[model samples]
Target chain A: MEAQKVLTPSKREQQKEARRNAIINAGYQEFALQGFTATKLDDVAVRAGIGKGTIYLYFDSKETLFQEVIRKNLFPIRDEAQSYAAEFKGTATEHLTSHFRRMYQALHQDRMPELVQLVMGEGLRFPEIADFFFREIISSNQELIQGIIKKGVEDGEFRESFNAEFTQILIAPAMVSALWRLQLEKQSPLDIEAYADAHIEFILRGLKA
Target chain B: MEAQKVLTPSKREQQKEARRNAIINAGYQEFALQGFTATKLDDVAVRAGIGKGTIYLYFDSKETLFQEVIRKNLFPIRDEAQSYAAEFKGTATEHLTSHFRRMYQALHQDRMPELVQLVMGEGLRFPEIADFFFREIISSNQELIQGIIKKGVEDGEFRESFNAEFTQILIAPAMVSALWRLQLEKQSPLDIEAYADAHIEFILRGLKA
Candidate 1:
């Protein structure tokens, strides 16, 4: 144990990298368990097996660490949405539905429920985080939905006067909460993918066809 | 001040009522200003101009006191949703649209945003409240929405294949955040009434005969 614990210059850098990862993992657990208000840097440091000073070497503040946790998790998923939406071409509703199916599947994945709770629960305290979400995640996906709906209407796949932006807003919250709710329950009548399929079907039925 | 402060038994009762009202008002302010975990009963009592014991006479606990504030303000409005929904008779879409319009207005009312914040912020820690809300509010309304959609499909006012339950799920969540976002400096354009109107319209267009 003593031999393995020693670090040279290059090994010190590797140890630093391990400490950074440990801090992030510890922060994620703390944020989830205690929420933002109750969580403390000291607790996180203890969990990470690092000193208060070592924790500072990687991140400046609790807020910054939490922000990075959010960024690390959110941007990749958002990028996934972009790539999925980009690959489709067909009826606007169909194209949009494919993207939603993928997004819904991702959202139904285990980590997302905790993330949703963190965001929805804490977003009120930090209005800026809500802004970040709207700008970086919701608004972009909404625009893509709007574009697809617009194209659908234009191509005579949907009714000519269909309003895409409004539809996105109308459908978004339900879609966001549905999976979260299903997870909250012990046994839902439907799993998330089934719910997503049903949701897309429901939306298609509601939109101007 | 002399006349108001006079303490006959009748006057004593009046003063007690006024003080209780003051306490509840103070509680709401404190809870909203600092959130539940940070808010102290002493601050509430101080703001109310009464002993904390006086607060106990009027309300059983801090949780109860907060619940009372919410119940007093919101229940009447919430109760109206059912009666309003009960009165409508038309095409299924028309009936459902009219029902949601009332709900949109109710959830969008100024009282609801802070109340919603209170629910999400504190309610996560106390899931009993969320459970009560689900039983008292969402469950009944969901049934009504589903019933209408079911009837509409049967009558051919909507597409015969309409997914009744998930459609209601889709109807929620967009307008859910409206009132809370109301006082924010930069709100999403998807507002309560606008989103409701758009949703009702979209659903109609998608399902219309």
Candidate 2:
């Protein structure tokens, strides 16, 4: 009688969300271990301890599931970075440096590196996923950096001639470093901390009023 | 008698070199069209007008043949860029910008972009090729640029505090732009010329004494 009272429509909706979250968590692990091409929904279902039909009910296809993995797991980092930036009170240089350092930490400590490898390596074959990543991740970060640079210019912290459209200039070093660590670090390891510091120094020198 | 004279050891050596070049040229086209994994020696032989056995006679494996393609076709462009820098007399900014512009041209107009994609996309699975690319191509370019930065600082064209070991900072924009062109341009196209100009402007301002 107690169970029946708790199993209302709202309770059923909560259960559905839990099931969806379980599938997404399993999907991320499977994709990381074997990559997108090799992963199977059945394996994902088994890993999640959900029925195959139930997995299908939640996700229409493997591609959809992968998209959710990106949205649910990776997109929140952007939000965190944004919130951290919003709460901070500092010079643009300090803010930029700290933001990038946090990004580096997140990239290394999380599954973000594997996700990056997947996009760079297999992205061409799957254009929709690549587009989604670019829109949700790449351009969003670029816009964030651009805003910081613009604010610096307005406050006379950076040179007035600084062009914000070139935010890619600010973002490239981190992107390259991450890709290097993912693919080529075994043969030619870079000290990423030093690399990031030097990048910050270089950009600050360029932008400093 | 004429045929026998033409079949002398020196003549045979010349013939061998010619055959090797032909095979490499064909191999590059095949790989570019079909990528590294799907490419086969039989097609390379047909393209080169050599028998399949002869392909093995010159190259023990497809990977070896691909490495030679990189060495023969791609390495000389680095030498050309270096020579361009060596002969130039200009400010550090001018030299660096011109050198990068040439690199941009080479990357886009030549086969360098294709080679980059092959290394990034297929490299983890083929450690030998990845190592060869890193040692021969990546580190060499970094060293070349580092030398340029050192020369600039010594001449007092750039700030004395400029860190030269962060050569990757200098190289990243071009590398990222090339990869973007190759992989994501369809969805998010960048005007690379404008992008390169912006990058140069940003770096030169940062470095200018």
Candidate 3:
């Protein structure tokens, strides 16, 4: 038999990182499918193709695993959007249009909608998870959107009355689209692209200075 | 021994109606709390202060009972909204303002938000229930809003491009508010009346001719 090659330290680290990611991805799917309360760690391990105990190496508990899943999958997108907003040099209308375009595109590719549904469905029942989600995702997102709107109002690109408080109203269409895609798509199909276009157009018109 | 008095037919009928109402109310509470799959008929019976068999006497199955609960609690509101729209005489903006005012008031009094949460959370897993909701509530509501939007476009009160298909976007803020109240209320308290006012202002401005 040929001599066995020894693994490098870097190689071992890479393997560990891959295993952690696998657990996170599996956790996302299981949580999306079964919700936070109903999701089982054993099933997540099975889906990840690892021993149940191995999950404990990466995550202390199911709640930690879930928080990690949200952080890994969702926080990066928000960070990217925040950086984009910081660097963006354009009319507020243009900024919002680009923002929504990116959001609609992300909705199609990422599992953000499923996460939103899971939170909306089970969040009240689990206040800790809800608090974490609110503090991390929802609050930051609202701030980002509010920043853009505030800049728009200052620049006379949008109505003076428009402020950060209306951030929820501004983002309402996308939330509706996400929920529709999740729950009512089969019964009443939504053309997300068209819907997104209308949303941008409507908001820009509404916010016109 | 004292002679027993026989009950009148109308009295018997009133008791039957009351019992049916009790079952429907209990079903609503249980479904809201435990969701569609987890709620048990026996538990609902216990809440209703009736035998499990009595539920079957009023309704054939759990699914049927759920349908009745939705129909009894939700349909009248939609019907009233529809009739109001039919007889409404005002600018589209005024009509929409009035509509949303009623909706916000109802959101405080009625259990519509919980039912909406239940449907959004569990409807995908139960397509039959989803279909019923889409058919009975969603489809009709969409039509009502669309009709108002269509009239607005025709009357030159709204932008020429503002048509019926944009109905979902128009009504989205309310949906978001309902969802926020259901899930994120404790973490982030929302002043719903102010939110409703903002929603109306935004939509009307957005649709301005």
Query: Number of the top candidate by lDDT?
Result: 3
- For all candidates in order, the CA lDDT equals 0.68, 0.79, 0.81
TM-score of 2: 0.82
Give the range where candidate 1 chain B is weakest over 10 consecutive residues by summed lDDT.
Answer: B176-185
Off by over 4 Å in 2: A2-30, A33-35, A38-62, B1-30, B33-62, B85-91
lDDT of 3 by residue, A1-209 (tens): 13333344466787998999999999999998888767899999999999999999998888889888877887888888889988999988889889988877766666778887777776545678778787887888888778888888989898787656767887878877887887788887898878898898888887888
Candidate DockQ values, in order, are 0.40, 0.51, 0.59
For model 1, residues A1-209, the per-residue Cα lDDT tens digits are: 56566644467778877887888888888886677777888999999987877778888877778887777778888897788778876678678677777776676665665666667667546777777777787777777787787787777776655455464544564444643363335322444555666667666666545
Ranking by DockQ: 3, 2, 1
* Top-down TM-score ranking: 3, 1, 2
* Inter-residue clash pairs, candidate 3: none
Docking class of 2: medium
Whole-model lDDT, model 2: 0.79
Relative to the true structure, candidate 1 reaches a TM of 0.83
Report the error of model 1 at residue A73, Å: 0.8
C-alpha lDDT (0 to 100) for residue A18 of candidate 3: 94
